[model samples]
Target: MAKGLNRSKLAGCAALAFATLFAGAASADGTVNIYSYRQPDIIKPVLDAFTAETGVKTEVLFLDKGLEDRILAEGQNSPADVILTVDISRLTNAKAKGVTQALDDATVNANLPAEYRDPEGHWFGVTKRARVLYASKDRVKETAITYAELADPKWKGKICMRSGQHDYNLGLFSAAIAHWGPEKTEEWMKGLKANLARKPDGGDRPQAKAIFAGECDLALGNTYYVGLMRTNEKEPEEKEWGNAINVVFPTFENGGTHVNISGAALAKNAPNRDNAVKLIQFLSSHKAQQVYAAQTYEYPVEPGLEPSDVVKAFGTLNADTLSLDEIAKNRKAASEMVDRVGLDDGPSS
Candidate 1:
C-alpha cells in the first residue's frame, strides 16, 4: 500500500514539471525580436512601454552598420521580426537586399503619412529630420536661403560639410537630382565643391564645431543634432557650438526643404509575425510617436503630433514633397555624380 502511494505522488510531480516547461515555451514564443541600426538607448523607452502595455516581450540586436547584411545571412531561419533604422538609403537598401517584407496594416497606414511610407508597404517612417544649414551667428546674416544659393560664388570658402558620399548628403543630392537633371546637378555640385571651407571631414556636429571656431561661416547638418548639442549637459562645449549658429532652412528653387527619416521595416522572415505587426503598429501610435519626438528630438511622422520644443525653436520645417521612392531611385545617380564631379576631393582639388 505504501509503494502504491509513492508511485502516485511521483506521477503528480512529473505532470507539474511538464506543465511548467510547456508554459515557459509558450511565453518564450510570445517575444518579438528586432534587428536595429538605431542605438538601443534611443528606442528602449518605447520598447519598455510596449512590453508593459501588451505583456509581449521584446529583444533587440543593435548594430552600427551591416544590419541588412546580417539579416540576409540569417536567411529563412533569421530570428528578426522587425528592423529599425535611420535614413531612406538604409530603408530602401534593405528592401533591395530582400531582407524586408511588406506590411499592409490599416493602423500603420492611418498613423503615418503616405509620403513617409513605402508605396508597396515595404517600410514605414516613424520620425523625420531635416537637413538644414548651420550659419555662424556673427557671419551669415541671411535669414532665407535657397538650395541654389549654396552654389553661388558669393559664399566661396564659407561652407563646411562631411563626406559627399555619406548617406545624408547622398539623400540631399538625390533630391537635387530629382529636382534638376544630372547635368545641372553635377554643375551645382562643382560650384558647391568650390565653396567648401575644407576637405569633407567629420560628422554633422563637427561641422557645427567648425562654425563655432570660425573655420567656416556655414555648415550643413541635420536638425536633430542641433537639438542634441543644445541640450548636452554632459558636454558643455557642444552646447556652446549649438549656440554659435542659427538654423537656416534652405529650399530647392521651387520646392521645400529636404527632409529624411528614421524608419522601420518588417523582416522578410519574421518568426513572430503577429507580434511584429503589433510592435510596428505600436510604433506608429500617437503615444510612441510622442516618445520618439521627445527622446530623439525628431519631428513625428504622425500628422498631428508636434516636435519637441527644442526643435520648434529651430524654425519651421517646410519639408519637400518629393517622394522618398524617387529619392531612392536617384541615389545611385547622385552618388555617381558625386564621384564624377570630385565633390569629395574638396574645393582645392
Candidate 2:
C-alpha cells in the first residue's frame, strides 16, 4: 500500500505547486509533474512502481477539486504533465476545458480499448467501475434487474441513491439518454425520481447503510463501494451494510450495465511530455493494472486483466456497448433532466 502526502500540503494548489517548483521529485533526468484529482494514497504505489521501473520520479500535487481550472489558469506555464482523475465525465470535461492535449502513444493505444480511450488520444482509461444496484439481500429476492426497472411502480419510494446530478449517476443517466433518446430518458428519470426513498444525499456507501437500516430496499452505486464496505476497517459496521445487500450488474433492456472509468490525460502544456506519455502508457500495462486492481478494487481497462476477487464476487459486469464518449456527450443533458424531473426532490408523498 502507498502512503499519502500530507493533506496539509494540499490546501492551496498554487502555493503547493510553487513550493515544489524546482526541488520536487525526479533527478537530472527530469521528473513528470502530475496534477491529480484522485487522492494520493490510492495512486502512490502505482507511481512508486513507475519510478522504480523507468527511473523517472513523479512529483504529484493532489487536489480534491479545481484540477482543470488550475491547469487552465497556469496556461502554458503549467508544470503539470499529466492529469489523473476519476470518472469519464471529468476526463471529457477536462478535454472540453482545453487544458488537455491529444496524445499519440502506440503503447497506450494497443493496451486500452477504443471505447475506453478518446479517439483524439487525449485521455485513456486505466480502471473501470460498473454502476450496479445494491439490493437488500433480506428483502429482495430477484437475482436480476435492469436499469429501466428501477422506475417500476412496485419499487416506488423503495429506491435509494445519491444525487442524480452526481457524476456517477450522471454517467449512468447519460447512458440512458444514449440508449433511449432524450425524451424517453426524461420519462425514465421521472419514473426513477418517483421511486426515490428520500431526497438524494451522501456518497454510494450511505445507500448501503440505508439498506441495512431498512430505510430502503434497493440502491444504485458503483461496484467498488461494495468491496470497500465489505473490507472496511475504520468502520466495522460497514461490513454489515455489505452483508445486508447483494450487487446486481443491472443491464438495459437491450444492453448491459452502465459503467464509468477512472482515467488520465496528457496536459496541453506538459513540461515533461515524453515522461508523461511514458507514465500514462505504464498505467495501461498489465503490471500497473494488477497493482491498481488490488489497491482500489476497480476493474482493469486492459483486456485479459482480471479484477480483484472482491470485485468479481459482485457478479460479472456486462458493460453496455455504448461508447463512453457518447455517454459524455449526453452528460449536460442528463444533468438538466435531473433538474427537469426534480430527481433530488425525492418521490411524491
Please, what are the lDDT tens digits per residue for candidate 2 over residues 224-265? 888989999899999999989999878997767887999999
Using all chains and alpha carbons, the TM-scores for the candidates as numbered come to: 0.91, 0.93
lDDT of 1 by residue, 49-117 (tens): 898888899888788988887766556767788999999999999999999999999999999888899
**Poorly placed runs, candidate 1 (over 4 Å):** 1-27
**lDDT of model 2 at position 180:** 91
Which one wins on TM-score? 2
List per-prediction Cα lDDT, in the order shown: 0.90, 0.87
Backbone clash pairs in model 2 (N, Cα, C under 3 Å; residues 3+ apart or in different chains), count: 0
Report clashes for each candidate as comma-separated counts: 0, 0
Best candidate, lDDT: 1
